[model samples]
Target: MRRSTLFLVAFFSLFILLNSDTRPDSTDTSKSVTQEKVLSHSDKTTTETEHHGAAPSPYMVIPFLLLLLLIAIAPLFFQHFWEHNYHRIAIFLGLIVTTYYATVLNDFVSLKHTLVEYLSFIALLSSLFVASGGILIKVDKKATPIVNTLFLLFGAVISNVIGTTGASMLLIRPFMRMNKDRIKSYHIIFFIFVVSNAGGALTPIGDPPLFLGFLKGVPFFWVVEQVWLIWIIAIALILAIFFMLDMNNKAGAKEDQQYSGKIEFKGLKNLGYLAIIIVSVFLDPAVMSWVPSLDPLPVGIREIIMFGVVFAAYKTADKNVLKANEFDFGPIKEVAYLFVGIFFTMIPALRVIADLAKENSDVFTSSLFYWATGALSSFLDNAPTYLNFMSAAMGKFGFDLNGGAAQTQLFLQNPDAIQYLTAISVGAVFFGAMTYIGNGPNFMVKSIAESAGVRVPTFIEYIIKYSLPILLPVYAVIWFFFFRG
Candidate 1:
């Protein structure tokens, strides 16, 4: 984990240097911070909005973006001097940056007209939140290979309900406890594969991208329809791979580690928590908008909703449980911090891509476009990335807003919109496994596992070991056989 952190710092350092002029931080001499804030006439540092009406000068775009990137990452270097709740500084900075960028970038009018208001964004974040408690749990004594397999199954099953992170928090301690006697137990990696990533594919609530899809236009029950197929395929592959690997680990087998355990209904009985999740969704566009729908949530009800959740969580989850798992708000805070800068700084790229879609609609229709968008989405922000491709498809493919095909020249005269949408969706969701930043949960999973003392691979190492070797093949197989030729 430390190594991965170092690697990421280095990577971002390179990013800062290569895009030097665009860095947005406040310098010792320079009074202004690009995306972070701009001191207003009123003395309040306000959002550093981009020129969002239409296309700005091409020269302005790159320089402004570089300035924004610098502002975004500027905090990393200063924490050594001032260490009291410094992370919060980044969080607020992120909020300012994302807000400024989204508001100031080209075509705010179009974005406002099309996508739901800023409230929806907040709702989306709230909906994605999930967590659980974990105590040390040992496996059943005298258990065999079947026991290990069952443990994996149990954790995987819980993932969809409570989320990958939740299931990890709930079952990982016990999962590790059960296998504690073995010195070479690499079972934890398989746990991450099945319990963390694959398991989250079943429901919108299970992962952020899927949740984002549901909030957009994708149906709620669509994922449920594929439950068995996705789950079985993911689980089978993981089991087969893990079992084969375990068989090779003579050291683990040599230790006659006695283990015995039963399912704790605390995690299972809390199944009722899904109901709270449902209520939360209704609160999104359906109800929350009605309450104090006047001022922008950033300046109004957004704070109320944020406070509301904190109050509820404090009152609900047991203190011991929270403490045991060390349920700090760090992960979500990190999301809030990092993504704000990302959304703001990358508006240029997004607008550029959006313009590309507007100009060349055929690009969205081609198979090359689908895979390419998905592949790039593996590295970029999949949401805006998805939107860019979607916009292109909408303009060119000539489909209705529902993503249905146009009924003219052939079965579907213009298939660009739907094709692009599918490509973007699939790319954002599946290939996200390639890198940590692709999806919110990717790094969260790694950090959580490491917090539990697991040996997580470095950022580059993750791609080399797991993604390219294991995930890409499975995703490719699924894509070639089902999606494309």
Candidate 2:
């Protein structure tokens, strides 16, 4: 791990030294003009010149790419070491890029923004993780194909209400336990596809990417309003496919041998905690809007509320509930450590994309945004990728990145902007199913399945076997019907 970190530092440093603009005078004026043109649209008049000089060169993207490669390859090639040292690696990479930005580029504002974003993002994810861990749903039914499909469908519906992570945590155990005697790998894959990814397309609470969008001024319901049809179609098709596959598999085997029992939900009080988080999500922005004098940040208040609720749930919930669920902090800790690096190193890549969008806004049509965002989100973590494309899309339209409810309203009212936003929303959420690393819950589900003695596919096998043949075609249909049209 140390050798890898040193190699990464040396390589990124050399690359940045050789490629990044060392002098401020070398900054592209055309990019500056484009940036100014976009920021000019803000409701608040800016006396300060927008720092188009901070446009990152393509060289700065190396750290981001290297980080992504580390995430993708390290686990496959160096599983034991990667498992033990991922957090350290993440921190090292983050510091390397941040140091470059601070010393070489003299851009601390970007670093500050990135860090703040990381904190808020991790805080919310942590709160959700803690709170969700307290709830356990026990299943008492036969593992029939139809019943399994119905459970997945139910998971898909509640995914929007409780979030993909929350819903996955609550349901995966029961789903696994119900079919433990007769479960197959395909069942797990389908669960990750429909329950962990596609189901999260309809609401801000459903996915981290959408929640990031919400915090960045997108309306809470805008996701549903824009992509409900796509969500419904995708879920319907996947469920239908699963039903057929299960039926065919079941027909060849003898069933009704596994014992069944009645279903029961434990830690019912956690539901209230979950509701508090959701309500806080919707209401915090409004509260911020009402009381402009709030200190620190309104989001901080929301974070505090969520953390408090999480603590309450953790204390009030029974210990046996967590034991039955086999709950642990490993998944959330992994996400926390990994995403911090993603948020930080991705700063320059996001800036470059935004600058490029400004210079050539016409090139980034709705279709382009959808594919670009989704394709990247397929391998990279979806939350930061979503924010990156969102910034570029906003810059293309000369919209304010920080504009909240009013900007969302304007975006909804404009037909062209609506197309881009909808594309972005659907792409980030739906394509997250393409890979385990695409979303937090994907891997969590995989780990739990493995612990339960189910053989989950490797990264390459999963993509080649399931994602490409199944998800890509569905995405193509969405692109043609929605984005292109």
Candidate 3:
């Protein structure tokens, strides 16, 4: 507890220092369009612009690479040290990059922007984590191939309504409990593939990248309209594979064991909290002009409401339900610590990639866009990758990224631009399953499963055994069928 308190203090202190100079230079209106690109469009007055300095040095990306290496191998090589010290390691690496930006480049705008994103990310995740933790779903049915497949299919469909993170938090426990007799790493892996990634492709509210797209002027239903077919194909193929794998598992309840074949739900009121969190997701000024923006603070009314849900849900939660779910803060704590480092260290890498994409925008096609966005989003944050590629694609036809809703509408009117946008959307959402760090929920789900005593694969093992073998082929099929032009 002392260590946790200290860690929180250190984090907020650093955040305060980083935002001490939140005043944007109104006189700097002559900056290039790249420099002027708005990091967060929700707040008109306090929007974070891209760093207005010379492009970041490519060598500045070393810290990010090192962190990734540590994340991938440390648990396998030195489990004790990694478990106890990971927070320190993540924060240290993050501070290294934060110092470089503040002292060397004197660029606080980018830091503030990344910090805001981190807050928003953590707020939503923690709220959903707490709220879902309060609700316990128990399935007493026999675990059969068809039943498991239907369970995954239901998770896939509802993911479009509640968002990937929400759906993942809400269903993972029940799914695991249902398969307790034969739960394996592959079960969790397939959950990540379908529910946490590709399943969210059908709605803007389903994923952060698509939500950003909606804020930039895409219609609310544009995602479902454009990618419904792709979503069906990807989900169906993955579920089919999962079904085949489940058939081989000989583990099951004993022949004489009885089953209730009923579904039990508890802590019903937390569903209201869940509903509040979902509704608060759209309370951004960019989405609704009446929503107030809390500029310079990085968080807004939505985040405030989410953090409140985190508190209220926990306080009102039934003790029995919490115990049944084995609810604890372990998973969220790990994600919050590690992702702070990722969000900070990857800033230079994102800026570099954005520059390269812009420089070669004219030569890029939908296929190239698909591959490039997928490759980077597999490791980096997918939301910004989606935005960067969308910007570059728009620039291909001479549209400003900061041109807001009207400009985005114009860009979409072009038939070719529609193709590029479709590819970018699918690639960003689908490829997020390629790695644990690819999306916020992937790591959280892995942690939850690990805490439940399921033997999860190592990070490298996950890629080598599961993702590379399963997801890559499916994604290739998607590209061939949809983005081949």
Candidate 4:
């Protein structure tokens, strides 16, 4: 516990040093349109009439539907020798379908914010490395009373900064290796609970929905500030549970086993790659500065820094060291492959929600959309699910009070349109913790755990066992007691 406190204090100090601008700056809310911009007109009659027209988003869905049909047939027609990892394929497709549904409903979100939010999420990985590396500096394999505790704290801290997946990837192996001799090690499960999910609540990169929220409206830093409270509580609970499990195993520990220090961390140069990830995530808005008319100079600068830094990292990383770490393209590749179809397939779902957004105002504020989307995201793809909810909420804004009838004009220009938008942003991001498959890193971590021979829960089994029993209940508490208020 003492070690955990020191590590957390160190992590905070490092976080402040790196993230010099972690402030909750508000967003630009006023809808400023001009003659230069072409826009559809609406009547200020009723809320329904205020719509710009039947959601003009059918164009986006046709491509997605066609693609799905092709995906279904391509494998059969090609007789491709490629191995089909059925579970992975199932989860990937689920995300695509959910995204498509959300897109059709107009619940989609933007891309700019996702980029920036993800950058910070990556940069934070450096801090995890540094902190974990610190413990290795003084590692005494013989007496690791504080190792599990240190890992749990480090996992949570990193979850906030680098994201749950990065933290888990960086720390999980070291954790298992440290306790290799112990026969009673249930630390892995607790590791998954804290290292993988519970701790990653604060920032958007910490969880995908949070990033989606940033894409939608919520300030980047606000999530970290407000979510720290939840992260801390979850961290504490996970640690306590892990301690109990470890203690039970310790009771049956072998007397002859001796401490061994086989694990050593080298390649400080690769540490720079971790930094590149952070810069990329934080400066996403700055990176997109060169897009035609919208020259967000900061985004341009950020993009340059990310590409330049990471490129340098790739050059400097030792092949031997990377091989030792077992760093493969598998995780990122899986994310890329699955998300390709997902990003396109879900446009229809988003468009549909965008069309119905004005009428479903209650869905946003009441958080039915948030919980529902997040829970489903646990098994589906979180990104598309997030976009779906965001698109729907934003659609509500397209309703023009002037286009509505005299009887319903008051509701169209209620001047409170932005509130619902923010609600979608808040709910979707905050609620992604309800299941494992909800986020990209969740399954990746589970796969890693299984590789370690940790006996991970099956997909539906995970939902019924870990998620439904633990996550859903706690999330319910957080919603009604913390978020709803």
Candidate 5:
């Protein structure tokens, strides 16, 4: 309790410091103007300049790197300490970066933007986590290789409808239950690869990055039109691999239990709450002009609605269903706390990447776009990475990212522009499967599986054992077949 109080006090202190002196000083006006010129030349808005400040010193990225390193290693080496104080550690590291931006850089706008983004992120994730937890699914069938493969395939498809986060939160518990007798780390890993990331590539509703693209003037159906083939090829390849792996495992249900081949479901009303959450995703002013803006405040009506769902869903949830699902707050809490640090410290890293991408826009090819966007999206937030690369791609064709839907349509009409955009979209969505932190759903899935006593891999093990060996080859094939030009 004392620790929780300290955490709140420190958080508000950081907030107060950032909000105190947001106006630029007279002495800094000239520098701000010069920085604005560079930013504008890069096709960024003045608002973006306010959000990112000048080109951050590359050295400023150290805190982000360090936080990621600690997140990866601390749990492996210092399990107890990390499990207990991760929130404090995350806040402490976030404070370092926030203090730098607030005092040394005097760029409170960036801090505020990060805060808003963090809130929206948490609001969406927490709502889905809570709402889905109230529902219970029981699959009374023997876990077979074909059955598991089909289940994952269905999950991938529905991900486009309810979103990767929604699908993951809804299906993971049932999936674990079905495979309880033979569940392995590979089961969860493949789930992450297919449902949580690659499955979401076909629609804006499927993933945050694609949704941002839709807001930026890309047609709502454009992703499906462009990437459907790539999505099919990738998902098929992944599912095949999962099938082959599953075939080798001979584990079956215990001798005392028999399969009834029946599926049981409860808490159907939460589906209405999920539909409301999905509808609320479009409540942003950027998407619906009729939606009022809450400028200066990071969140708007959408976030408020989603957060309200979190409270309402939990309060009205059936106790029997909740107990059946073993629902708790542990997974969401971990994602919320760790991601705050990630969002704060990653400001400079994103800025540096944005600057580099813009400066070299003229020379970049579609292949480069795929790899660069994919590499960064593996660690940083894929949504912003998608936007940054799209901005650079648009600049390469003499267009502005903020030039409204007409300008974006004009850019998309160019054959070359389509190629670049496709690569960026695919990279951002597909490569998000490369790490647990790549997308919002990955970590939550991992946390849920662990809480259920699944033997999940460590962060490094996930990368070295599964990602490099499996996903890397598949992504290379995708690039070769589609974006090699």
Candidate 6:
């Protein structure tokens, strides 16, 4: 705790010294866009926006790095404290970061935007958790290598609809159950690669980071068009590798007790609730345009609808169904706490990256953006990391992504900027498979696999043995074929 406190103090002291000059200059105006229009379109903003286009000093990004470092190291070194008190650690850092943004910088507009983004982010994740938890799929099938590969294929496709978390939760157990008699650690590892991370590249609804992109003004269908080919190639190569690996492994004797029922889906009503959530996300912006008086009505309405769906699912679904799924609030709560800090501390990093991208546009080609975003995403949570790179790309092009339809149009029209955007999106989603902490579902899948008596690899073991050898080569192929000019 004391170390965390001292780190916060050092972070803020450095930030204060770096950003001593707070006043905007003449160049700030020309580069900065219309703040009112930007605010009117996004979340939790007052009618004020600032176009301080002078590149932010890089030292101001220390807090963001500190937050990422804590997230990476805390679980490894202080498991008990991190598991039990992650929220407290997150709150401590979040408070200091928020105070810095609100008081020292007096830039509450951007801060509010970040806060709103966090809220929308948690709301969507929680709603998916609740809705998907209610629906349970029970399968009674033998675990052949072909069956296992096909199930993974199904999960990879369903990930775009039910989300990586939802699809992972809904299927991991069934896959584990079928393969219980002949399980290998590699089975769980491949599941994480295909279902938990790479599968989510196709759509905004597929992953938390992509959903963040959707909320930030990227069109709902943009990811599909941009990432579909990469998604196909990645998933195909992963499934093929898993099949080969399974073929080489020797199977143990079958379990004495076998499940003897047809494939069943309990709490089916949650599917309807899930559909409602998807439709609300898709229609939020377009609906908001129809109601002129309600300038910032969509986020609130979407959030309300999301919460309502959660409530309805909780009330309608049986307690036994949730118990069967081992549904709990720990994951969602962790995401909420940590992301609040990430969203706030990332302000300067995003601003600086954008400024650098604009001035040194040649430095940010498609391949460089791909590897940079993918490497960071492999260790840190991919959502904020995705937003950071997107902000940089937007900065490179000298425009805010907050200008909903107009910004989308601008991106579609600019081929170079679109290439960077596509590379960032693909890298953020695919490389999340490199480590357990990279995506929300990776650890969850690992936990579920362990509870079912599969001895999963330790963090380093998993990355070095499985990810580096298998996944890295596949990603290299993606870069060579798609991102290389």
- The backbone clash count of each candidate, in order, is 22, 1, 0, 62, 0, 0
- Top-TM-score structure, candidate number: 3
lDDT per residue as tens, model 4, 184-288:
324555566676766776777676556544533355676566556655655675566556556566532367865565556666655556655654554433223
lDDT of each: 0.49, 0.72, 0.87, 0.47, 0.86, 0.72
Superposing every Cα of model 6 onto the true structure, what RMSD results?
5.8
What are the per-residue Cα lDDT tens digits for candidate 5 across 327-425? Answer: 888888888888988998898988888888988999889999999999999999998899889989999989977665677899999999999999999
Candidate order, TM-score descending: 3, 5, 2, 6, 1, 4
- Root-mean-square deviation (CA) per prediction: 10.6, 6.5, 2.6, 12.6, 4.1, 5.8
Q: Give the deviation of candidate 5 from the true structure as CA RMSD.
A: 4.1
Residue pairs clashing, model 5: none
Ranking by lDDT: 3, 5, 6, 2, 1, 4
TM-score of each: 0.66, 0.82, 0.95, 0.61, 0.93, 0.81
Ten contiguous residues with the weakest lDDT in model 5: 38-47
Span of 10 residues, lowest total lDDT, candidate 3: 43-52
lDDT of 2 by residue, 1-485 (tens): 45755654553454344334333233323334533333211111111112344566678778778878887778789989988988777777777787787788787445544544555555566666667778777677777788889999999989999888778877888888877767888899999999999998888889878876775667777888888898888888888888888887753224545444678887888878877877766544332444222222213456677768767777777899878766776776677667767766777776665565556666789998899889888866676667666666776666755454466567567788889888888888889999887887888788788877899888778899999988899889889889984
Give the CA lDDT, 0 to 100, for residue 338 in model 6.
Answer: 65
Tens-digit lDDT track for model 1 on 23-120?
Answer: 23232123325311322111110111211245633543453344333433343455343234333333344334334444454233222211222223
Top candidate, metric lDDT: 3
Pairs in clash, predicted candidate 2:
140-261
Better of 1 and 5 by TM-score: 5
Scored by lDDT, model 5 comes in at 0.86
For model 5, what is the error of residue 281's alpha carbon versus the real structure, in angstroms, after optimal superposition? 0.2
Residue 444 displacement in candidate 1 (angstroms): 2.0
Better of 4 and 5 by lDDT: 5
What lDDT score goes with residue 199 in model 6?
93
